[model samples]
Target chain A: MDDAPNSEHFTLSPIGHMVSDYPDKFGIPRQPGLAPAANAKLVLAAPYNDPLAVRGLEDFSHLWLSFIFHQSPQRWSPLVRPPRLGGNKKVGVFASRSTHRPNRLGLSLVRLVGIDTQQGVVLALQGCDLVSGTPVVDIKPYLPWAESQPDAKAGFAPQTPSLLAVSFHPAALDTLTQRSDSATLHALIEQVLSQDPRPAYKQKELASKRLYGVRLRDVDVKFRQRQQGEATTLEVMAIEPYDER
Target chain B: MDDAPNSEHFTLSPIGHMVSDYPDKFGIPRQPGLAPAANAKLVLAAPYNDPLAVRGLEDFSHLWLSFIFHQSPQRWSPLVRPPRLGGNKKVGVFASRSTHRPNRLGLSLVRLVGIDTQQGVVLALQGCDLVSGTPVVDIKPYLPWAESQPDAKAGFAPQTPSLLAVSFHPAALDTLTQRSDSATLHALIEQVLSQDPRPAYKQKELASKRLYGVRLRDVDVKFRQRQQGEATTLEVMAIEPYDER
Candidate 1:
């Protein structure tokens, strides 16, 4: 139509950056709250660090963070196969919350635990799905009454993704005990490995016998997949301090 | 930290534009589902309009629309006074759902009524707050389990904004009777006026006695404010077709 409004382009700058436990995308939960013990913080930058800016933020229990899918491929396709859909059956990119979107923007609902103004404004967030050092473009308080629709159908992913049973060998348990934050570290590893972050296509296949390793925080978790009845299970074989070299 | 990742810049092209009754920003509902009667259609652009791109989208009752605030000022403040807080208290732009932000990007959850693919894709959305012809950069089906938080506390405007009692004068009733879509027009007028879309500063002043008008759809609604004790009421005095001149 002649009255149609033209779309205007704008440049966006990061107001903050996230410091998360998951160094790479390999072991990060697909969504927030899935990893309750996952610790992260949004460190504000420049003018955004003013303490007065977040005066009333503590009252809200949850917040929505809009961040870029920094590691996703730049090219986007209209249709994508969602891992939740067993990586089969193509669905529209708009239908699935795939990161390969027109704009690689991601929206995640994270629990707001506390705000630390001692060293600038760092929002202590729990259950974050972002990888370490992800740039955050925007944040907004999650209004429950207006946002929640518990009964609304979720289409493909209707229920919470089933979790895998995780077990650690004696050697792995001993390594975990050596850490100063042993209790917290153990819980974090169990919570993360329970999701079975293996590729969707590999979920049903029998054990490949390959020792798969994923870097979480400052440690490298080595695990192997084992067939458990109708489901697959993960066994932690080793936990070694991450070697940057 | 030396390991901190650098923020990368991205350029996004709009996939669609909305056509709605709200021509300007003045009386638009601050959030979606606030104005259920406010009808809008997101007409998809080329490439994005492929029928396959919308497959299985209808199964989801709601969708998340990522749009730009085309009319907002280019510059943003770290803190802003939200009208819900009586426009007195300042909250971080991130803590409040303010339009003026680094990206000018807004995420709104809208009820997806239907999808028409006969001539390109046209999604019928209800309870959307987007202005007419607003550019839509991305659309994703709202996953209830992931997005909803029924019990989370909402700061400032915790509950829905209160509605005011609206009455139509005899003259206004007469004007409505002459309209072809009288029933729909009457409902639209009632739905909009009930919100009491006045400036926060002007809402409490008793009996301003001034005739206020707002444009909804193709009509200019003329009404007056009357204070009834603690509650404010609106009386529709006349309804005139919007004057394009």
Candidate 2:
């Protein structure tokens, strides 16, 4: 294999694109399954349109999505600094789930809500971590019996996220109230922004910015940033639903 | 990134070599952590032997080994047929844990029993699944709290393996009985071989072979193939301890 060094390249075409309410990368949970109400729709491509391909899928409550981080434009390094580890300690790229790699593949387990085959093929998913319009290569049904091992230990991320008392500004709540499924959308926005998604190093720049907004599906979510020493405080600004051109 | 397609290529060097009892790949488990007692040692290269590099390593009981599969001489395909899935159902290479990948980098979590820094760093590990002389590019301590998700679901693999009664021929037992800690070695051999490590398609040629031997550590394990109607069996032949020339 080492004799011919140039003979190992391969390519892949995305089978579909994931359309999620998440329009930006910053506020999406660092991990999937953290927000169960964040909805996304996977629109499948043609020739792979066979409805039979999705048979026995309804039995699974979640799926493993194999995807590519097509946007990352960097070469892989043997070692990487993970954000979860404070981005100072260097760990092997394989050990950390870094987007940069020899191959840019990313795997995330997301909740499967339902499937629609009427117009074409669409898989409704929740707790999606991908940005809107991210390409999806493949999906496999999650097998609970084989996948779950209750005895396994987790290292740095041992603490389950402490539930916070979330509140929204009156203006932001009014703006969200005008949308369909306003309650669901409000909960998602609150849950995501509350996690303090800014890079750890950017904590200072974020503190002074009073109004920060993220464009989501038909909505421009605006929020205010507050700093309590090292931790961040977020107050909702307003939600502007999408307006057609 | 698209403008400079050829500029993305990079090279890696082996930081160390893996020395395992299993000299060949024929009977090795498809994945590590399957057989916990199989041991191996890693010999580290110079320059990386600065005692400071291995600081804080003894805290973990296992490590994540990043290595290359230097044997298989084939280009990768987008899809591969996994032997565990009967080799009939084709799954994307990314979805299945197949060795044939665009880049043949392999990752295994092995039990780290000891780390000797005094003499050119030696890592004694258990549950090693690599073939003898495999080139290891990097090693990082496995943080169980971050890496292990007992609640996570596996995709297609069944939760529990079916029961099978395993026994060795009297002659084979006699040969193994001569070794120190023969009980552990016997159990390791039985557990590994019983998994039927042969390729799914090799049944036709394998059926006629009466005797097969695997060399590991200082022993040559010889066994005979038995078939009862549809069921297959492995009868032990002889265990010849290695004699260094």
Candidate 3:
């Protein structure tokens, strides 16, 4: 018998597309489980929607999602700047979870909230960093015993990044209160801003006045940062309906 | 602009093939790290063999390998009988790390022992559960802080499977002593058999005498089980070269 198996290339179609709260990639959390209020749904495609495909998925509390970094640049480099490493030092692409890979594939672990099999299989997920409409190729249940290694040493990101204090002005709070889904919007803003979504170099600058806006659902959230001694504060300036034409 | 991303399919090619000690699937460990003595190498293919593809990978102690379960059966069932569950109780295919799935993909975490870039890039791996000739698609460094969750609960496989005691017959030990790599061969047999690689149902049977043989490298290892009160002992009867014609 031949010792070597056949060497062949394979192709796969997207199994589903994720509908997430973040309309664009900017301000998205670096990893899942960082923003619990951010929820998404994986809407299955034609042939993959059968309930049989996900029969025992509910037993697993978390899942591994193999997705495409659709919005990232197409070309790949040997080294990349990781946001966790302050985005200045270049590390090997394989070492850092950069988007520009030979294959634009991204792996994420997300909490599995529920699965709807009524019309089709719609997977409810929480704490996802993927932007809205990300194409997901494969989904596998996370096996904690086999996958987790709590004592293993982490090279660069040894601990979770410190969070910035977030507060909204009365004008922004009043606008959020008038919205039908006020609680979700309020939590989404707090979750997004607490991560201090700014360029790594810009993060250290104290009191530099620059307003940033991130689109979430049908709203535009405007926020600014201020230096408070050792800690940074994110203040929500306004919240208004996003105009698209 | 529409918030939804373009729905498109993606294709991937095998980056390399694993050269493992176990020629067949039966004696392979159920998970990695079960048999640390067993080693394998991923010999890179064209294009992927470029050293730049794996630059800085040595910095990581472990890596996540996405591979194909090429030798598994073509069809899959929603419910699969896991050996951990004694092969009687059926659970969702996603819940268990069954080889058969909608896609023939398998994921494993292996220790990076070394990398040979002299002729072509060959990645030396330890504690691999993959069978020989398995196709590997992608390799990513494992970040312990993000990937490891020591506190996470494991549903079915909560702890390492119990090991069976093993002993060698006088005749078998003499035959192994004549081999050039006797030390390695001895350790291989002991490591492989201690996992009790029998069918889950057969494990409970007290004294049913059945001889079994497994092929590793260029040799065939024969062993039989004998019950010792509550524990089972595997006695190696013989070790001979595996002939291929």
Candidate 4:
């Protein structure tokens, strides 16, 4: 028998790369801007390094990011169960935000913090859920006038996410105090863990584990998952910024 | 050896069917809303017949329609040349609106003319570029407050399409006059032909006697291509409604 034919291929050059504190996907928020204090940086590629590219961008409080899901495997399926739908009901992949798609492109709206053009081009952004080292395909300044709709229907994910009440362990708090920017680090950690970023089904299995630690933005986030009747709770243990060895 | 695996083993039950005056693909505006007078109808499926599902739709003047490119062949390439980009420069299939896709789903924004709950939950739409039998998967009301961005940057395709000047033959005008709704029919015919729907690089052979005809809505348009000074021109010969035998 003859060898099977290989599918066609193409190369995509990233316009920029994302640098965030979250090195792995395990604890990253499901959607960008879900954790407001989670900051990330954008390092522009050559030829795109012109400061003029970012001119008039600072006026906008937020920006839209177009990026590739470079890590997702190539195989695809027609249907995918969305985590937002409790991961039980099956829906067409095109109707849901599943990483397994015909094309692995992803679009996310992120908050723009600050831009620095002095050394190449670095954009400081907050609430960036992208994993560290993720390649950004394109970035455009967001027009709030055209994008904000208070009355628009959100379909199944209509309910706004609830704010979680959290408390930190005294020891974990001590580790954070040793950092120069302890307040900022503490706030960032609290914001992320409070959202209960774990996969929905995973909650039942991890119920007995009192302390959960996640390393993000060069900090170790220790938290405890508790249950008060029907309500699920997450208590922050401590946020300690890593020390360079 | 075992029987070869079947590559084409799938059936799609259309969630709903689209009925547009654009009986054929040729000369339909490349983008919807370009021809305001053009209208179409959508008929939903059995289980989706509840009128209550459309309760909050009246507030929006437009909508996002997710549909399948049922006419396109099932297989696809990784890259495709977009007709909007002059059909020479190749872009990833995901980036172009080319029908050949891993999953042949299409997204179009169309103007909502009106909704009729009394008659089988039908929705009348204007400026729809979809063909008559296109299958619609889902419909979401367009929130202009969150969607319209005059300042937002568009890649490849500019916000407004370039327009071309057109002239029709007297014979074609005479034929159109004999129709019951001649005035409306002529206006619709002129709007469609002016868009220059011919494929790029289609003039490969110079067969002087050949005439091309495009069927639209309730009319048949016959035209001949000719050179006039520095520009190519289409000389219309006749416009008649399709006579079903």
Candidate 5:
């Protein structure tokens, strides 16, 4: 093996950052493609914003984004408790896609809805789970022949995430009617609530009257989950403009 | 929306390097899983070599490897000529999966064969395209539910690689009969040659009698391509131990 010097470390400067719908880590979905309506805009920085840098990128329908988990803790552990495993069982950090690892690298596959160059190079993306201001390191077009693996075994996480039923209150429905792009934001709220975005312990509590606030776009969505015997449903109480207090 | 400071720069150090069958960059497949017989061993460096760090990873059948193109030049271009496109027409660097880009990051999907830690943390991988001593920055298990996309539209690279016919010379066949793992090596040589591992311009030459050499393992594999009428065939001339001078 070739043991040469200067190969030990590598530096990656952000080519761009995402202005996604996700405001914080509290309500963001764990993985992409679950919420297809959660769209984001990727804005390229400084010299990289040259239109020539993404000349033929429009031809690609999907792309792979290599990004940094900027919000994860700097200290890492050898083992991690995956939320999918009920956040109890321990598995090697590599076995689970945990952000707190030796490296804070994150990989995601996003559908390219459209590419715009009005002000700078801005890309409209769908099915993204990254938060706003997430630093993107590299972007590559997805090769179907080389990457598609439908029959692969998924060890622990076998099934797709189960969805919960969601309903809107009279006040929340009124808020949607007054908005111009209410149809888009309405779908985003329904999809985000369907994933049951709550801690394992909170999800297990029977009929706990905890009103959770999820920030979607510029509104603070206040909702609560109710359990009637074996069935559970999330109902939105109100939707108001977020106040940074 | 977020103008956070210290979020633009990221640093990644090598967790380990691969000791693969490919000795140099001359004959390695452009994409992984091209040559199933081609195997490699990834030896983890200290601190990352802890056995607990890889626990439960055996359950997953495949993994994603994030590596650096250390052998490539530090300079990059916005446009690239892909060999898949006959190396004539140029495409934006982002449209193609060329190693030369804004960042030197390379992503590959490989099947995890086995993991051994008798001496250190050595992982046996199948269907890799990386050369020996290739530095790896991160490893993550493949999530079938989140990452699988068989219906994706590939803009340029739409089809799987087409392979050519490969034959062994009398001396080359004789050399295989004397080796212990000839079956494995024989299949690797045939699969490698089937891809027509020659420059696009060289493949168009009028049956030029130029002999080519590819180093596989510790041997120098001498081969040539023969053209007749409209059919082309590659033949192995000899398999001899390579000498470094």
Candidate 6:
């Protein structure tokens, strides 16, 4: 274009950091709302924590969070294979919501529960698929009138990913029964496993099953696939404290 | 909170920029899709323009552009008066989608028409409410199933903005007849004027009607409020060449 801006780039400071249910990227859902048990909150710092900055925010039920893929490698690739496409066919980074893209920027639509201003600006959120400690740059109320479109065409990823049946092994069930927060942990584990957290390549090789573990909260959840007749169930083998080093 | 990432900030480079029907910010719609005639395109540069970067993008009907509000002032205010709230009540910057936010970052959802690879990657888009020369940092295909929620609650802005009735003066109609692209210009003008481009404060002071001009393309569109009893119509008084200096 003849009138493009001369300044090619700019810098921004993180307004705060996230505290989410997913401890790492390994098991996080590919998209928000895929795991409703995945709760989160943004803990503001320094100049951004003023209560007045969040005044009248409760009226909005959802918000758009602009965040950074801080954990992804800084180097970016033009084309990437999305897990939704079976991690086989290559698509542009922009075509697929891959973390390996220019600028490493990301967007997540999360439900707004409420705000806690006792210690500072702590925004309680739900259905966020981000890893804990991710950097958040900006937050904007979701304008449903302008944003919501039921008839939109979503190419390769047409619908929510199909779920895999989940069950617990005897030892894992025994461990859950001993914990006070068993219900919460159980629900979180069910939500995480149903989405099948295995790498895309492994997801295809269902016949040769193996153990896979992902850190959720403070426990490492180990699970493997069990096929019986026509149905396949992802059975949780064990849940051990992550500090067992 | 104990696991918050220590890294506080980062920098980014603009992968592309915008060329749109909106020449300036004064008359631009507050949100995307408010004015469908507000067409636009993104001109990508350098490594970002590789055709491989946009492969498989054609399948998706819409995209989200994360851009910098380069035209807005660098400084930010904690409180802002949104036109939706009658411009009297103040809300926190985050609570409202005002241009003067902390990072000056904005998100726009635009319909993708197609891509042009004659020179570099040029994205043809529609329903964009951003000004020309916008610095776009990232582009992601819109996933409707997760994002579309008609039931979500919107605080201040609950619906599409109401528009005033529009009509053209005799002189303005005469000018339109001489233009080769009269149909395109006519549709653009009607879409813009009906939204009532006057500042929020002036919108309420309807009785003291006066002339207002906004630059669209290479023409200066002059208009004013006309209250005919219970009906209030915005009348276009003139359409003169933009370079009248």
Q: Native-vs-model 1 lDDT? A: 0.83
What does candidate 4's lDDT look like per residue over B61-124, in tens digits? 6666756666778676646776766677665553345677544655666766687889557888
Cα RMSD of all models vs. native, in order, equals 2.1, 6.2, 3.4, 10.6, 2.2, 2.0
Clash-forming residue pairs, model 1: none
DockQ of each: 0.63, 0.15, 0.43, 0.07, 0.65, 0.70
Highest DockQ model number = 6
lDDT of 2 at B200: 67
Model 4 earns a TM-score of: 0.56
Query: Candidate order by lDDT, highest to lowest?
Result: 6, 5, 1, 3, 2, 4
lDDT of 1 by residue, A18-108 (tens): 9888888898877788888878999987767788767788989999898888889988887899888888889988887889987787888
TM-score of chain A of each: 0.95, 0.87, 0.94, 0.85, 0.94, 0.95
Cα lDDT of candidate 3 equals 0.80
Single out the weakest 10-residue window by summed lDDT for candidate 3 chain B: B1-10
Which stretches in model 6 have alpha-carbon errors above 4 Å?
Answer: A1-7, B1-7
Kindly report which residue stretches of model 4 are placed more than 4 angstroms away from their true locations once superposed. Answer: A1-245, B1-13, B149-153, B203-210
Highest-scoring model, lDDT: 6
Error of 4 at B229 (Å): 2.3
Can you write out model 4's per-residue Cα lDDT over A38-63, one digit (the tens) per residue? 76898876545566556545656666
Best by TM-score: 6
Task: Write one digit per residue (lDDT tens) for candidate 1, span B135-209.
Answer: 888888887777788888887878888888999999999999998888877887788888877888887679699
Q: In terms of DockQ, which candidate is stronger, 1 or 6? A: 6
Q: After best superposition, candidate 5 residue A160: deviation in angstroms?
A: 0.9
**Each candidate's interface RMSD, rounded to one decimal?**
2.2, 6.7, 3.4, 11.7, 2.0, 1.8
Model 3: interface root-mean-square deviation in Å: 3.4
Give the residue spans of candidate 1 off by over 4 A.
Answer: A1-7, B1-8, B243-245
Q: Which residue pairs of candidate 6 clash?
A: none
The sequence of per-residue lDDT tens digits that candidate 6 reaches over residues A1-245 is: 45443446587888888888788899998999978776688987657788878888899999999999999998998899999988899999889899999889999999999899998899999888888888899999998888998788999998989999899999999999999878888988999999988888887664756999988878899999887766777999999988632
